[model samples]
Target: MLANGNVLHPRAGRAYVLRGGRIVVSADEIRNADILVGVDGRIARIGEGVSDPGADIVDISGRLVVSGLVDAHQHLDKTGVLRFTPNPSGTLQGAREAFAKYARNAPPDDITRRAERTMARCLSRGTTAIRSHVNVDKDAGFNGIEALSALRDSWADRLTLQLVAFMTPHPGQDLEWLEANIDAAVEKADVVGGTPAVAEDPFRYMDILFGAAARHGKPVDLHLDEHLNPQRPLFDAVFDRVRKFGLEGRTVLSHVSVLSAMPRDAFERVRNEILELDLGVVTLPAANLYLQGRDADMLPPRGLTRVAELVRAGVPIATASDNIQDPFVPTGAGDMLEIGRWTLLAGHLRGDELKTVYSMMTDIPARLMGLGADYGLREGAFADLLVTDCADVDTLVAGGADAMTVIAKGKPVFDTASRPVAGDEHRQPAGSG
Candidate 1:
């Protein structure tokens, strides 16, 4: 809880009227407008002459304001542990082995600290929403869930976090490990997920995941086909289970790198099914670029799935930063703009497709995370926004970490122009500002 004498000394009922800024309301709309934030922390009005007599009116001329970026896929616990765990082989299995060994003894506080550092980086760079996966098998157990769930409550005022209880089938990681821990994990998790593609019986693995999610009415986000094999039995299995379990519009498939290797006809057919099923697809460009295609003897291809084509097909797609400074990719700062820029360059999407790329960062993933009207810049919405010096969305993506201010729930919680790591504090209560 925040004391009356908390450092910022701002109350939750604090109201503000931002004036003269170029607000990017959505991918299709940009306008010079003023936004009035009410005492209840939602946008009261937005127009040319919006005003509140008692509200603090800040002049934001010459600034670009947009909704804070949303990261759909990430690993919070494994972030910032590269030095403690090294993957010399630089393959997915090597990264898994190195991290599993380190996690056998990973204390809860250490996990919280690593997650805190990475989240600070993300928030400072204007990513206010994230869906992070944590290991829930034998070696990792449930320590990560306990640690991050607390952070989820403490940080709710500024950032939205969705936890995925990720099941692993690494030998003994199965058997009694999931049976003992999965129920509790699902109750505490925002989504239930697992690496079904690697399981001995992929259908059985999905049965476990779907059953747990059904028990709690939670959503599903699974990792499958994390390779280049065009044969998509794993994806086919996922589509089948989603249909069988009535999980349509509530399932997300991450790291389906096999989609890139599918034949043109096959991709179109699968894309049509995805459209009908309303399943979400996530592409992790950075980690895939590092881990995929290592076995190729000649020039390596870009390790991402067919991003532009999938988006063109009207599938619900998101591009995200999967691993940050971990054994998975070994390099990242958790910047969504960096992720956006990399997606544009690596996916071979044309510059004219900038609006489509911007949607991945703000709209598509936010909807999947269940953050809808309250997330974006509109009347009656929660006033979480990113104000920067860039003139437009394209400029913001091209310029990595320029000085900016992050506003959460209508209050200026973090201003990079004046401070550092201010968003990391979880001590203050949300209502106390």
Candidate 2:
């Protein structure tokens, strides 16, 4: 397909040949290969010399073609509400208060409009998959679910959207309301999730979520310990319930910022439990950094978990943007690269862990969402990929890439020219220090 390495961007929409690119099958595997996408929305073949005379061919030489990025921890229901409901204090409680007030009056159509814009931003920037948490309570009822569910069905062809019924509790909306309406929410969502740190009894909060997941046979994802105080740790409940509900492989923990401040023994205990349970860990730094550690007078603590240690321990950890232009974060464009870079900074990860960092945005998160089996660049995998303008993983994650030519399920959706500015670019040969 790539004659003499002749380069050309894919122009055909449905089925085509992505010829000659550095195909990143995983964090550690990179191959210069050609990909043939069949009309059935799966990759027909991928090899060094793949070709097809009958199909359209687009040579992507000198570029990096990898699996589409995944944002596994996002609040889609509360996205794009920064202007409508501003969190002037920029604290966790402030965001909760502001959004809770806004949710009471926000209409379903309005939620749909905001979420649709957010999804478009994510898709154009090469995030072809997302697991968004929708707030579910008596106050909002199923409005958030209603909006995201419709969009999920419509965007099924272009993006893989997994909805989590986030059992939420605010000032006016308490735990009772959330418990009462979780069933309806879980029925509409792909996962069962909640923030146990907010509940009066953290154990009770976790039990409710795990019980619901067990009853419905759904995966569980909970926002845990999103604060800076070491004494406020709530991971014990999560570790116990994973075994109690037999949700070891089906459970995911998000925003475990307390791990950063925990004592060594406590940290090791949690880490051991995580490894024992075969759990999925998602560290969301975007909103954590924005909303946590407000009371610090001197050098503030970075609101992130022990990412480097957890990664070194072989834990299935992923990172994502928890909020986008919402009361919680106030600034974000649904860029997974930006989120990855932030994870490295806030989590104090080393430069040699670039591949692992890249995985946090792609394969690791895909695995956390239970899409790992068919998520990456393989012969029979879905052709959900992005032909990015980067020489390698370091250049791409270091912000040296431009717009992405996204292809989802063998179909070229749109070639967008805009992406998030992930600080400064850092490119030094692939294997260099």
TM-score of each: 0.91, 0.92
Which stretches of candidate 2 lie above 4 Å from their native place?
A: 1-14, 172-174, 416-433
- Local lDDT at 373 for model 1: 80
lDDT of 1: 0.82
**Backbone collision count in every prediction?**
0, 0
Residue 210 of model 1, lDDT score: 90
lDDT of 1 by residue, 1-433 (tens): 2333232323457677777778897787789898888887788999998877666667666577899889999999799999989999898889999999999999999999999889988987788899999988778878888899999998887788999998777854554567567899988889998887667667777788898888889999988788887865477777888888899999988888888888888878888988899989999999899998999999886878889888888888999999999899799998898899889889888888787888998999988787878788888888888877665776666654345788876777677542333543321111211
Worst 10 residues of 2 by lDDT: 424-433
For each candidate in turn, give its C-alpha RMSD to the true structure in angstroms.
Answer: 6.4, 4.1
lDDT digits (tens) for residues 74-187 of candidate 2: 888899888888778889989888888888888999989989999988887788899999888766778899999999999888889999998886655566766777787899
Backbone clash tally for model 2? Answer: 0
